[model samples]
Target: MGEKTLEEISKAMRDIDITMLSTYAANGAIASRPMSNNRDVDYEGDSYFFTWENAHMVGEIENNQNVSLSYQGHKHFLIAAEGKAQVIRDKHAFKEHWNADLDKWFENGIDTPGVVMIRVDATRLHYWDGMDEGEIVLS
Candidate 1:
């Protein structure tokens, strides 16, 4: 009904494993793709995703850190977040967030060539669920 804290929003987002990450392409068109959260949804106003350094998404982020993430869940629950994205290439940092499932994508694990982690530090998050709607600002 009213505003919710970061914890409450985080709880609601925990079940959401995938988010549509949106960025601006070289042509200035909006490009979006599904990004797995790896069940690391302890949302502390930040989110992380894994991708190859050579991916188009990585290039998009390099051109513009401004990005958005959209989440959809059961019962029509929805969330949208705007943030600045940072590309991380450190193996140690990647190790912290890496999981076994990622092996399916990177056979050599975090050491896989060009492996990179995208960290989004959200500045604002807005949510809606039928009659309940609110926003959280982290910046």
Candidate 2:
């Protein structure tokens, strides 16, 4: 029934492990895929997801940096984030966001060749829960 702060929204996001990451496809169509957060969400208007360099989403992000992420949690909490994406290839950056859960996808973990990280810097976050809904703009 009241506006929510970024911190409060971040707290709600902790329980959300997967988010739908949407991007603009090369064919001018909107594409979306489920991305695991690996519970690495510290919020602060930023989110990260790892995928292979050759993945379709990577190509999509390359063509268009603008992206959106959708998240749903218990208690009717939902979030939609609009942001810009950067594809990171640096190993150091990989290590920073890497976790054991990712080993299931990347056989060698952070050392896995062709592994790339997509960093989404959210410029705006909109959320809804029950009868409450609000938006947070990040500068």
Candidate 3:
């Protein structure tokens, strides 16, 4: 019923494991895919995801860092986050967010040859919970 604080938004995001990452493709079309957060929802306006270095998403990010992440939570809560995405290649940074569940997707875990991390630093977030709605702006 009021403004949503960053802490409150972060707390709500913990329960959301998947988000629809949207990007602008080179063909002048919007591309979107479901990306798992791996339960690393400490928030702070930054979200991370793992993908192959050669993936189309990586190419899209290279051409346009502007991206959006959409999350749906319990009780009809929804979040639409707009941010800039970066492709991280450093294994040391990967180690910080790596999890066992990802082993299913990337064989050899962090050692996987094409593994890359996508970091989205949110600039604006809009949320709706049933009839209540609010937005948060980050610097």
Candidate 4:
């Protein structure tokens, strides 16, 4: 099989719901948290999930682009990427990724202050599917 591209990775992301988000601090400490998809294919270019502008996870990415997002369904997979993340104060990107439930935190909906968008550029993938009795082939 040919190696997967970013679009392929983004498409594969549609197979799962939740993903583990990994970030780091200046001290080299790594942190991981469970994040939900705002929509089924939220990892796409317009994927929208909300985070406080002051969150440590947000700070780490701003400081360093090295990060990872992993998801598991009938198989396990991880996407390792490096990309800078800055607060997307623009209302357009926010609106594109916006979800109504976000109003709980952002009273103004997509116009809520301190809401940001994380733009991640995926670079690598380590994945394996062990959901069967043995190696099986399909045609």
- Model 1: runs farther than 4 Å from truth? none
Q: After superposition, how far is residue 118 of candidate 3 from its true place, in Å?
A: 0.2
Q: Candidate 4 regions off by >4 Å?
A: 1-12, 40-48, 75-86, 131-139
Name the weakest run of 10 consecutive residues (lDDT summed) in model 2: 1-10
lDDT of 3 by residue, 1-139 (tens): 5587889999999999999999999998999999999999898999999999999999999999999999999999999999999999999999999999999999999899999999999999999989989988898
Global lDDT of each model?
0.93, 0.93, 0.95, 0.61
**Superior by lDDT: candidate 3 or candidate 4:** 3
Candidates in descending TM-score order: 3, 2, 1, 4
Model 4 residue 113 lDDT score? 70
Off by over 4 Å in 2: none
TM-score of each: 0.96, 0.97, 0.97, 0.70
| Cα error of candidate 1 at position 134, Å | 0.2
List CA RMSD, all candidates: 1.0, 1.0, 0.9, 5.9
Please identify model 3 stretches exceeding 4 Å from their true place.
Answer: none
**Relative to the unseen true structure, what is the C-alpha lDDT of residue 68 in candidate 2, on a scale of 0 to 100?**
99
Task: Please give the TM-score that candidate 3 achieves against the real structure.
Answer: 0.97
lDDT of 1 at 59: 94
The true-versus-predicted C-alpha distance at residue 133 of model 4, in Å, is: 15
